[model samples]
Target: MLDVLSEGFKEAKLKLKGKAVLNESNVKEAIDAIRKSLLEADVEYSVTKNFLQRVQEKALGQEVALRAGKGDSRVAVSPADHFVMICKEELEQLMGPVNAELNMAVNRPTTIMMVGLQGSGKTTSTGKLAKYLVNKDKKKPLLVAADIYRPAAVQQLKVLGERIGVPVFHKEGADPVTICKEALQKAFDLGCDVVLFDTAGRLTIDSALMQELADIQSATKPDNVLLVCDAMMGQDAVTTAKSFDERLSLSGVIMTKLDGDARGGAALSIKEVTGKPIKFLGMGEDLDRLEEFRPEGLASRILGLGDIVGLMQDFQKVAEEDQEAQALKLLQGQFSYIDFYKQIEMIQKMGSLKDLIAKMPMQDMIPKGANIDDRELTKVKAMIDSMTKRERIGQDNLDRPRMARIARGSGRPVKEVEELHKRFTAMRKMMGMLGKNMGGLLGKIPGMGTLGQMNNMRKAASQMGQMPGGLGGMGDMGSMFGDSASKPKPAFDREKQKKMRKAAKDARKRNRK
Candidate 1:
């Protein structure tokens, strides 16, 4: 998403090429360029100054050490390597640690008060966190509608609460502070373990809103004060974080709109100045779209490579505890529609369809203006729901009449039903091939273990699902394995697969050539 920042880093790294040492003269030019890049990315002016100063100090130190021939000048690391290391270390430190987990032990019925300016997705995040706690943490979290200024705001929270199966504590005409106080009492009485207070947000950091937030803080004495800043707001997000922290005594930050194509200077600068861990990230508008913030993965992503590690962790968390073994088995080609449906639900829990696509290594492989439709996921989900359990498990039982009946059940046309059948059949055939060649493919990608590992299975499932025709699509996993497999014909054949792989290999070879 931080395409601009990634490009700037690439440019800065290129400046050090052919340089033997990072002396003051050479390093000064490089540091100045980086400083300008940070400013252009909308990083706070003060943070940019101090950050560059640290990098410059490290760069100059490295140059001096190199001239002294410390140990081995023959094996001296490139200045670009050293430069990247310095930046990566400083950026990680600025962004705090790897991940931040929500606290549920802060005096039972832990109160989390959300504060931010309007359009920060404060309301949506509150519901997302409540859903996460209920589903992931197995805690009873009550969503309190304390933002009473906008009448529709309360209704919005209630609707989200209903959709996610969480209880909303609200009083339509009551004052926000009063509603919160009552909600806390209600939570205690109902034996709820967590309470999320959604406070009012203003257009900007105004005094009235600040004072109101302060009043809520004093009244609620919340265990965690989460400031929801929007990445699209840029440096203004930093300013908002600072202003909100001053009034609310924020415990952590939750940067929303992270899925946007902005440079993401806000997330980098917010944690730097606030000195508070970013507890959660709101990537989309869905109730289940919240992700725990991880600095290393985010930094890597801003550098333009996909965060494969982060994607694995996201899948790991969403996978059902009991379904782990089954999911692994399904990867070996015994996957039924029930197994497939569970995987789909896990994916839905992770985030938006667009978000998952953005994280694929093949994202750059796709041609421009290809009209890669994302709505197919919804269609797939609908078809799966339409099938009876017996039919889902034993697809051989489905004849033309049965297919039409299933299509009617799902409210989809018979053609759609046929499409699903074709895709599912393809998935079965492809998995058999993956079973044979997964070792080599898995080895090529670092951190992906054997095919049976949850990580590899999830990655393979996502990649396989995204190919053309999805499962029935010609480029599905069937094409991934060349001519070796015998008997049953898959959706794709040997020649098509050979062409795709040859094209991929040629592209890499051309880069070297």
Candidate 2:
């Protein structure tokens, strides 16, 4: 979502490379790049200017000893890395301290009044918030359809509530405030502790809308008033948020359509502008696609460092008890076709593969034009489904005749099945090698010899099934970042580079033939 900002930071980092320190000249250039990127992303002019000024002051004020190749070289942080880290820290500070919790009343049902302009996804966000509260917080939420002016707004809320298994309270021809007041009573009667008011929205803010919302607020005495903003609206979203907060005293914001081509300026600007935290990000249209906003995670993603914590959170959400065992087995090269199919299912549950990949660190390593086709996983699943249990578990049992039968059953070519088998075999071999060689690779690092031995012991225990499930014995991932910081960059190997180029040329020639 912050693709433009990410690219800009990457460019700025490159510009700082080989430079000694963050002096006025170099700092100006880097900040200019950032300024252009933010402006292009539709950030508010004042916010962008203030942010850049702070970044510049911080960068220029840092000790010269902190520069790359200065001070104690062993522990010296590179200027480029230092500058990027400053930017990352500033970005996080600008966005938030990670406050997404909804405020619930102690004695009564927590009335969460959802307010926004038309087409801002207020109704959909209401359903998503309900589902989140139900599944994550174990709250029984009653959805209120208070947007009586908009055609089918009530029906839409009902459909969303039905899909999410939340009860919808709507009374036709009722005033918005009256509907919300009645909805609160219904929540009390139905044992729903959370009441989500899906209030009406207009194409633009007006006195009539504001007065109606104010009336509803006065009657309901909501615990939390959240504005559902469209991230695509950019600066306008921030303006709308400020307007709403001024009137309704919004508790927080939910940014919808963040998965679209949003420049992400609103997400970065709204909290700073309105003095409200972003509670959730509406990543997609699905009722289950809402994500609690994590400022550190977003800042990491914006800096192209990826969000490992968010990725793990996503994994934890969909991971089954046996899935961890399966992952361990796959790492040990003992996984079968059945395990492969199950892994695919787990990934599908986690959401889009592209989105998942985007959360990986150093994602720029992926080929620029290459795309991950989710359909490919479905195709693989279809082929696996066509296979007998024996054939799935024992590849050696699948001779040409068996492969042909499976291909016919799967409605795919026999060659495609063969190719899949070949790739699977290669993957198993590579994973096996990686598992065995990981300790050695770690030991080769400057100060990780003890860690390498520990890793080996953990690996041994994992192989014997003595370790706990879900990477329990994999040790702390935080250590990896520490190791990376202390480790020396690898020297380029000319021979290896030449061989890679030659191999690529050969592959292209073979394809043409």
Candidate 3:
């Protein structure tokens, strides 16, 4: 992702790194090359021009000095570093200081209007965002089917609503403007705190589509307007974003198909040109796969370590709710056999725990050839069900005799219960300590350096296996964490990996039809 920009900048940096002295001719040549790279990456023309101008200005201002070292003289503080730093700062400035999230009104009914080109995942993303709001934010949400032009669009919204158990407001053969008016009325009557309107899309921007969208905006006056754009479209994504912003005046963007092999130009360039935050990215078609956009975290993923920051953002959204927050607060201290069970359940809502950890730097820490114990979660849950609330919250309530009785009641062995108790106790202690140091130490861990005080407790799982006996149970833990690794990874479930393949096939079929 962002490979073109990454490769372009790397090449430009190399050009200036070897030179002994920087001159006007070589500097201009290098800056010119960088400028072309940005242009070719599908960056907006205006953004590219301003970006290159700043880099050139900074390069020209720096005084190149030759230092006599071991064998010959070399250009100290190579223009490459200067050039890279300027581009980084300007890119960051363009993207903004902090990534923005969906602005769901906390009051009564938060209304969001989605607009974009057809097949940009506007309808799919509308459902996904609604799920995020309902399941993660704990907000009562209702979906609005406002795309009246396409025959299947309303049914699509209805299907998604049923799948996620959210209500959809739509009337066949009704005009989009009228449907939006009725939808808002329904939201008010139902007391839905958030109403997500799935608007119409076109192959490209046209006056008619704009007029329809404008009419909906005039009628509904949605609290937020999100433009959904396909990341695989590359330069096309930029042009479409520009057109939509001019018409709808979007509040933010939702970039779809990032899980595909796209170069991710849309993810970077949209905010730079359109001046709107990328609120969310459709990593997969699954309701749980949508992730909040984080510029620095994405930059790290493109560089190397996976987007742990993105994973934290997902958890933060859910954990912010009162019930989930209270559960976490209770588990921070002593872990009982019962609390251990509750933790397993809470973790699942956050996404595949194994996949979440793999995206971060700790992928190598798991046991070699041993499939992640995604299934063991159920067993743990069963064990917790056997215990009383008091025993679940604190093992102190369970003595040797009590442990035996609890195991018998749960239909598990005494050793299994004891081992779970031990692991949970250790993990709770580790997490509590990590909580204190999250602002400084845990934040320093590569891509996670920025979360500052808001570091999510989910990150503490990586450190658990690093400690003694933490990984001993998993087979071949040594090779997984060893310097030399083995070959042949176990196959993952084919059905679970549906998003990318389906996205490609869908795009192809859509183009053909």
Candidate 4:
């Protein structure tokens, strides 16, 4: 994740806090933070300079305006919020307006030649791209093993092709250009809708490599020439893109290893430096993890508002229609350990838990750098497996004797088992309250009600199985092993709760004026 860039935006926002309007003095301090972040992220010198200049111009003297709310409820938003909006827009303008589509939309048997520096994850990206097209676009793809220089490159492509049920076209002892030339006919013969050429790459850009790539381009004339770059390369990735674009005339870029702690400068710099869009991002090693890059979504995440739309999209991808009905049942307080087990499986397919939280509007509430112990999911599963049939469904009383019996069977301590039961009971109680007045809870959160609002209530409700309290109170409704304990717990004694209710009632009565 781009933690560096996100941290910079957060610091900039903090610098502008309590200010009535943007001034040169305050704006300079905020922009200095951004400038330092961008440079530290390895963003190109010229691109960083130009981007900061644009942001400063837009933010200077900007005025806070009342949010577009109805009646007397409208309130003025802060100037820091206005500055973030400007930054998000400028960031989007810098990276995109991307056409995330491959050239195969109109062209039949579309040929896409993959090129990049060696060790840039080009071969792996080619395989992932094929799987993505097949899954997302219902494409019949032909993978051509044209990277003859690398050892086992052809075999690697063959393995990937076999795994995905896509055909691999390669000549056992031929040059890169000839292999690609023949694969074009193989695609036509096999009736493949697309052909991807996994071309040879070098340790560094060289005359020989460029000439080979140029030769393949002349012969095959691919509709899309994508350069797969490692996002961890930072500034070097931008340089690599420039060199390849000069020789091969690239159509797009696929950034790989974005799941790692890449500074994110390369992703921001490539488009500005070389005028190419990053069409796809390889987030993880999972074959299904290739994602279409969204500039506005990325920009919003950078500003720490989180992308609720993106979060729902991811939820929809891993959830089936029937699961929506099940989720509705769970949301209505008909939860069970069986349902919890299924959700754990669904979330495992969704990738890292921390990344999922980053897309949430309330991510800041969770302790930063909290080491989430995802292995706890497996431990929970083991504990559940040891439960009796009745206990697996729901336990009327999880007494110490039963917990000790289950802990012994699952090879876990009694304290661990008791903790798991406590979490489940807390969740069960919360869901019961939620099923009664989720709407009221939605309206109570300060800024989040607007930021995390959704048009599709069913879609949002369906995500309850994947996550709890999708609307608000995200810090308290945490992952199975998240560090939510680090957050301050509220005093919830009966008298305290009664006093809080009275305070809320009095505040509402005062609002009538």
Candidate 5:
């Protein structure tokens, strides 16, 4: 989402490389790069200025630390790292020191009022929020359709509520304020713990709409009044947030459409302008795509360092149990085409492959001009599906005739099928080697216990290895780690080492002859 900002940070880091300290003379170009990046990302001018000012003040005065090198390679903390650290800290501070938690009423139903401008994704966000509450917080949320002015708004809310398995409360032809007030009572009667009132919005801020929202607010007395702003709206979203906060005194903000080609300026600007914390982010159209806003996570992402914790959270939501089992199978070299297909399914459940890769820490390692097409996964699945049960379970079962038959069934070339089989076999072999080495390392560690007994720890390591490229270029994990594991290794035994050295010397002498 903040691709521009990420690129900017990368350029800034490059400019600071080889420098010893973040002095004013050396950091000016880096600061300029950051300033340009923030502006290009559509960040509010004043906010960008203040953010850069803080980064400069802190970076220019910070002391650079140096440490001992490994194998004669110097390991000093470069100016780039120091400057980047300062920027990361400042960005985190700018977005948040505190995450705005939902303040639900203890004794009674907590009414949440959703307000925003037209086309800002208020209705969609309302559905997403309802799903989040029900699934994450275990709250019986009653979705109230009070956007009576918009055509089919009520119907849309109903459809969304149905999709998420949440109930919707809508009174036909009733005023929004009245509908909201009645919805509150309905929630109480239905034993719903939360009532989300989706209030109507306008094309632009008008007194009539603001007054109507104010009346609804006065009637419903919502526990939380959240303004849903479009991240793609940039500074306009910030201005809208300020106006809404001034009129309705919003408790928090929800930035929507963050998964789109948004510059991400609104998310960085709204909180600073309106003095309201962003509580949730609408990442996608899926009812389950709303995520709690974490400043540190977003800041880390903006700086090109992938959000590993956020990635794990996504994983936990989809296949936590299956992942554990799969990791064991992978470690034991027991995974087959069936297991590979299941892993692909698990990845699909997590989200888009591109989005998943963006969360990884090694974006630069991605080959230039290379695109990660999720369609590739679907194609691979199709090829696997064409195979017979025995062939899928046993690689040796895929003879020439069987490969040709499978290729015809999958609408692919026989060569492609053969390539897939080769890649799959290589991946299995590499994973087996990695698992054995890791297991041996663990077995040697004092008090760590046997590798077999440490299944949980092994699974955790396997999960880390299961990144984009780990499954033999399935994602992009292969690009980061390469095929180094598959290369032949020198013998570690002293006698074997001596023999290898003598053989190498003899080979050189033979070449000279």
Candidate 6:
């Protein structure tokens, strides 16, 4: 997501590579690239300056040189890698430690007060947090619609409550403070362990708005006061966090719209500038897309190292609770179109493919021009729906005629249907290979890498066409995603291809003439 920020660190790594050791001149050259990137990303100047200083200080320190060519992990660390390690450690330090999760109370009915500027996604984040509590934390949560100032804010919260199966507490013609106080009683009646107050936001922070929030906070005495800042707000998000922290003494921050925020200055800046932990990151508009903020994973992603742990967590969220048994069954070779359909659903629920790929170290293994389309799942589903019951259950494997029928029924090309079937066949074999080793992988997510499962994945990927960096190239990802990367392509002879195409076009023109 932070492409610009990543490019900076990548450039710095290139600058330091093949060097005997870190030196002030080379380090400064690398830092200059990083400095330009940070400023371009809209990071706060002070935070950027301080972060670079910490990174540079450690990079040139004696420990880095001593540890050069050695690593705590299995792999050896080169000078360039050691330098990047310094940068990564410093970046993680700057972002602060992981919040673990929302700070809940020992007693029942933990109150979480959500505050932010208007249009900052306070209400949506409240619903997402409630969904997180329900799905991940397995606790009863009540959504409090205390944003009475904005028109339809209560109704909006009600819709979200219905969507997430959480109860909404709102009073007609009641003030925000009163609504919050009464919502506590409702939570008590409902036996909800968590109560989230989606407090009213303002176009701009003002005395009257802050006073209203202060009144609610004073009355309810929330256990957590989270300020939801829009990531796209950049430095202004930092400013908003500052203002809110000063007024309400915020417990933590929730950064929203990170999926759309390419620069990611706010996410990197808010924690350092405001001295608050980023508890969760709001990735997309989906209620289930709120991710717990892990500084280590984020720092890795920002430096283009990829966050395998985070990627596993995303997979765990989608598959652990509802689809664990199903996923395991499919992995055990009982897979069919019915199960493949569910796989597509799980992938869709896991959010965007591009974002998922961004969290993988093998992201570059994808073909350079490959386009990972989320809508491809819908198309695959359409094709599956066109098949008969026997075909779906894998009792009657599809022949060419059957595939043609499905293509016509689904309004797709026959080649696409054929490709789907081929990819599905390949995946069925791969899953059969992985069935034994990956039995409990879904349940052990976020730590699956440490559980000796990455090797299992590599083995599974090898059962199909192996890619350079593992994960079975685009063929396996193609099997999962049904994207253009379903087949690995040879590196092109660009000039040869260009000349051939030009000659063909000229011959066609001559024939026409």
Give the clash count for each candidate: 3, 0, 2, 0, 4, 0
Model 4 global lDDT (CA atoms, 0 to 1): 0.81
- State the lDDT of candidate 4 residue by residue for 346-415, as single tens digits: 8777877767777888756656665565576677888888998788777557799999999999899888
Error of 4 at 440 (Å): 13
**Candidate 6: which stretches are off by over 4 Å?**
63-74, 101-103, 106-108, 320-334, 366-370, 429-513
lDDT of 6 by residue, 19-119 (tens): 87788999999999999999888999999999999888888874554443344655555778888888888888889788746667887788899999999
Please list the C-alpha lDDT of all candidates, in the order they appear: 0.74, 0.81, 0.70, 0.81, 0.81, 0.83
Please identify which of the two predictions, 5 or 6, would achieve the higher lDDT against the true structure. 6
Q: Write the per-residue lDDT of candidate 2 for residues 115-234, one digit (tens) a residue.
A: 999999999899989999998989999999889888888899889988988899988777888889888789889999999989999999999999999999999889999999999999
Model 2: lDDT equals: 0.81
Candidate 5, residues 213-289: lDDT per residue as tens digits? Answer: 99998887888999998889888888888888899898999988877753788788887877789988887676767
Model 2 quality (TM-score): 0.81
Candidates ranked, most accurate by lDDT first: 6, 4, 5, 2, 1, 3
Where does candidate 6 have its weakest 10-residue lDDT segment? 465-474
lDDT of 6: 0.83
State residue 471's C-alpha deviation in candidate 4, in Å.
20
Stretches of model 4 off by over 4 angstroms after superposition? 66-73, 105-107, 395-397, 436-513
Off by over 4 Å in 2: 64-76, 399-415, 432-513
Question: What's every prediction's RMSD, in angstroms?
Answer: 9.5, 9.5, 15.9, 8.2, 7.3, 8.9
Pairs that clash in candidate 1:
423-472, 468-473, 469-473
Range of the 10 consecutive residues with the lowest summed lDDT in candidate 2: 466-475
* lDDT of model 6 at position 172: 88
Candidate 4 or 1, higher lDDT? 4
